[model samples]
Target: MSGLNIISNTSLTMFILIGIPGLEDANFWIAFLLCFVYLMAILGNCTIVFIIKMESSLHEPMYFFLAMLAALDILLVNSVIPKMLGIFWFDAREISFNACLVQMFCIHSISAMESTILVAMAFDRYVAICNPLRHKSILTSSIVAKIGLVAVIRGAAIMAPLPCLIKRLPYCRATVLSHSYCLHQDVMNFSCADISVNIIYGLIIIISAMGLDSLLIFLSYFLILRAVLRLSWEVRLKAFSTCISHICVVLIFYIPFIGLAMVHRFGKRSSPIIAIVMANVYLLVPPVLNPMVYGIKTKQIRQSIMKAFHRNATRPELFH
Candidate 1:
């Protein structure tokens, strides 16, 4: 069959989402587990944001960036997990083309923002540790707010063209997506039209946006390390400890992210299960763990959480 004929014949109005390949029989179990994780992620991230906002002590740039991270985690998981539950539990597997594009935009653009936030957090740490006296002067509330605005604008600019690019393509192959959500790579893979430009643009965005962010983060940490080594032994330990949570969060996000990227770009012959697992790990685990890490490792956040819980417990119920 000619490509044009195939394109004309196939209905690409809606894409089918198969939640987790090879786990169709265990969808009930999967749905339950996913739901639990989703709730925990939402609760944890919300608490973090709420605490950071309510506590005047956490008005510093570091906490400011941390709050941004928590909020992004909420958005990141929300874009996928609810729909996933609908697929697994309700068997609502269909997503309209426009809806799929929106999902793809949310997933990728929010991911880019998360990376930028991480880099900003790294810079916050760098300034705090390396230039303690200048930290306050350098990263004022105005500067941090500007950074947040830049993250949003940059993410939107980079991902804005992707949906249009994919929309212009003619999808002639199977419309069934690889995961519970739509991904640009998966959606474009089914297109009958030549997607070399799309593929190239995608790579450019990844390399220029996320890749550059990674480099800046690494450089910030390197400077931080150098500055710490020059400090007293106890002070050195304190500086390293301050960065532990951010480091853990970064690893949590980037490790699975890299795995999924590799699976998409290079693992065409790899198992569908591998891709799906990587995608889930990349999207879900960070949201679940980021707040937990910050809550346990950052003393102020922990105290705020305890205070909130105690306050709620001490309050009388209106039903009484």
Candidate 2:
């Protein structure tokens, strides 16, 4: 408890993070478990990126999009998990005002980029399964690079203003944060200045970015469904099989994200621990599960992973 250096008054330079609230008795175990999940997520996402990079057969637009998704997952996880562990393990919960805003930007911006990439992936799957003939020609290398660049720019462009907005606000009250990480919504709650602009802008950003992407993804799948229904039963199954991993990944990412958003928006009266846990799920589950889902459902990725391992195992110089 000695590390809980809470400051008061308008001159407060640090924001104290109460990790897992009522779970202080279990933060040791919690830190250990979260550390394990963080490792798994890092390892899984890294493996996905490495496999896609190495396997020449996977050099297509689909795998390229997947590699981008995996990379986003790695960045997203790395942006917060280490700071979270610091809170739990070392009582290093005191974050300077500027550092908190930076973390907030990283979390939201990376999330925006990830959402954009997922939409790109859905479009790729739609092209591959719904209109196979035009898939390769439509999704060229140059086009894919442009899409990746757009994702980066869009995320950075949209989230870049958040830190500035937070910076302009004066913190006249308690600056303690609820979650282990600094979220835009969470940090804005402590602002003593009028936050209506922040609230409205944040809502607009969510609606325009993630909300629009979700709708586009739904529209893509609907069209694909209609196209699939027109094909023969076996071909339809095969087409759907190609999309299964992506669908799982989308569901895992969006469901918890939606839940966390709902909790922040409507469940303010709910338990803080619930929001804490939901936030963790929103952040942690997708990275840890995405690669596993892809490895299981996509034969090329699975074989590539095994082949990667086997190739490493056969090297004799390592034994020396």
Candidate 3:
């Protein structure tokens, strides 16, 4: 019995995820704060999805992708934040090895999917603005669905190997993750086994997918700008008005993403904190800003939100 107990005690079980400093170390307050962020993110994204779904006028391809983006944001945040909050609230910061891998897979997968979806959205906008006559045929509902499916499959394919790589690693030290979540890079750093392959594959996947996506997005906008230049002043202004919000959103998403990558590659090991903060930004910032961006820029969504609120306010009492 004693030998069995020793074996059990020695077995690698839980990983300690060092959450954000300060409040995270204090107590449940940190958990509360994280929970609040989670709730806000969920609610915000859900509202976007609901508004897009219920409003027939938003049945266009762009709105369809926006809805998908919202749904992905909800999935991405829920997967990481709940587990992270649990780490803060409970003493049991130890997540199972498999669980850690799963978290990393889900987070990275959804992130990649979102990136791809943004690229698709950029392409959709380019087609709409540059070749207005061909918009309908170019962006049919069937084509949109196909693109969404391709995004999902590509995301899964890109991230699927990560968990397998992690599982194969032999952890020599106590598995204490340095961040609030099961980040793939953090997990890889803990491995006792050689991780040159893992590092290479991770960089390749991130650079090839995200890097290429951002490049395409920039090229799309460049073409869009050239097209805008050819138009009359009134048409150019209108086009810019429609596109400025999306451009802002793309910048918000990509700039920090590239910065984080560069920091990770060149900066000291202590830079994980920066990476963690940026990771949170990548996950949370887009969802919070998305509705606001679209709401201000999109006439239909704004009207729908107003109509929704007015209906709620004027509804008859349930008791009656």
Best by TM-score: 1
**Residue pairs with backbone overlap in model 2:** none
TM-score order of candidates, top first:
1, 2, 3
lDDT of 1 by residue, 1-320 (tens): 45344453225678899977777889988899999999999999998899999989888899999899889889988889999999999899999888999999999999999999999999989988988899999999999999999998888889999998988888764778888898888888888778999999989987998889889999999999888888899999999999999999989988898899999999999889999999999999999999999999998889988998888887877558
lDDT of 3: 0.81
Compose the digit string of candidate 3's lDDT tens values, residues 24-71.
457577678678778877887898899988889889999999899889
User: How many backbone collisions does model 1 have?
Assistant: 0
lDDT, candidate 2, 1-320, per-residue tens: 23344333335677888888777889888999999999999999999999998899999998998999899989988988998899889989899877887889988998999999999999999998877899989999999999999999999999999988877776644677888889989988886657999999999998999999999999999999999999899998998999999899999999999999999999988988889889999999999999999989999999999998999888987788
lDDT, model 3, position 201 = 93
What C-alpha lDDT do the candidate models reach, one value each?
A: 0.90, 0.89, 0.81
What would the C-alpha RMSD of candidate 1 be, to one decimal place?
2.1
RMSD of each: 2.1, 3.9, 4.0
Q: In candidate 2, how many Å is residue 283 off?
A: 0.8
Ranking by lDDT: 1, 2, 3
